[model samples]
Target: MKKSIALFIILISVFSLAFNSCSSDDDESNDPQVATGSFEIYLDGVLFKQGTNAEVGLIKDNQGNYVNTVTIGMGSETGIVVSGFPATISDVTTMDNDSDPGVNINVDSDYYGTISGTMTRTSASKISFDGTCTKLMEAQVYTITGFVQSTAWEVID
Candidate 1:
């Protein structure tokens, strides 16, 4: 009887140790990565400024769904950011000043207006957007066009 009890305890200990072992592969796979992209801003059909390294991220909406966001520039500097939650490929997502939907492109420059664009996924890790923005600020009318591409966007939040 004592021998059988000892054998059962040994088995239980071995099982516990096996279950508690940590796997590096599993841990690394679960980690989130940052998304990156690039864009060029054109003012009145002329190239005004551009960014080679932009940051793209995923944001969760109230419905617990993921939305893709593209952001460029800094807090104090001229910046342009847009968010689109495309359900499928080639879906045109739009953002405007009056609409103010969560999924909209926001221009934070001296000129701010309605930015309408479409986001297309070219590959599993790449995306491209073509859009036009028109804004009238300080009695000056500005028309801008943007061509943006994702350089590196494969992050999970």
Candidate 2:
């Protein structure tokens, strides 16, 4: 049973890896220079036991630097265990603003998110902020609870 579950997780990760970059109708900037880099996502904040599926991409910073845009995708990863399943996550959710930090690619999700008191990394790569965005029909309040030792990512490519 454990082996089967692991295999299933691996399959899901590989399948998700084939996806294309997010849609940006307009990706034009007047930056002076561009530097490029790579990134990787780890599970439970463990670089060694990272999620089977991680997000890797490049970015064009304002300074004309083209860096790899890395993020944690919606799926099962090491250390994070979803309730009611051996190891699986069902949907993917993302949030982004054209601006930087809180306004730019914060990428909140629904499947599993950072618990409160816990924090997620905002764009620019150091600060942590809300990524688990929720919608309340009546109250319209998003209670974001982050995780402890959650997804730890680094720029590696």
Candidate 3:
């Protein structure tokens, strides 16, 4: 009986050790998560579509909503800065060297934003929003006025 008990405990410890070793706590980017959020679209300095761009914002906010803005470079004051580029930002680290805090910009410089949220193409060249942002039908829409694209929400997922 003592030998059986000892075997059982050893087996349990081995299982626990194996499970912990196999767990993926080492890599954050490679971690698989359900990507879901709102989206906005733009084309050639125009808001041709709001849901065209794949992946809008990173994740839901404190209020359980995804938000991001699509903007192009208008000058030194507008546009979105690519994640790696350094020249495309202001004093704020969140504010890329390109995208502005108050305006969506469309310039030649990397016309893209942070690739967050699950923006898999449910349809070719098309994207959809799911998860924490289902009721964002109205607030997450973008408006194209001539050469400018505008968003009302703080984030554009």
Task: Rate residue 113 of model 3 by lDDT.
Answer: 25
Q: Of the candidates numbered 1 and 3, which has the greater TM-score value?
A: 1
- Highest-scoring model, lDDT: 1
Name the regions of candidate 1 deviating beyond 4 angstroms.
Answer: 1-33, 62-64, 74-76, 94-111, 115-136, 151-157
Model 2 scores worst on lDDT over the 10 consecutive residues at 79-88
For candidate 2, the lDDT comes to: 0.28
The 0-to-1 C-alpha lDDT of every candidate, in the order given, reads 0.44, 0.28, 0.27
TM-score of 1: 0.51
When 2 and 3 are scored with lDDT, the better candidate is 2
Give the top-scoring candidate (TM-score).
1
lDDT of 1 at 121: 54
Per-model root-mean-square deviation over C-alphas: 19.6, 15.0, 21.8
Candidate 1 residue-wise lDDT, 115-136, digit = tens: 4554555544444555545443
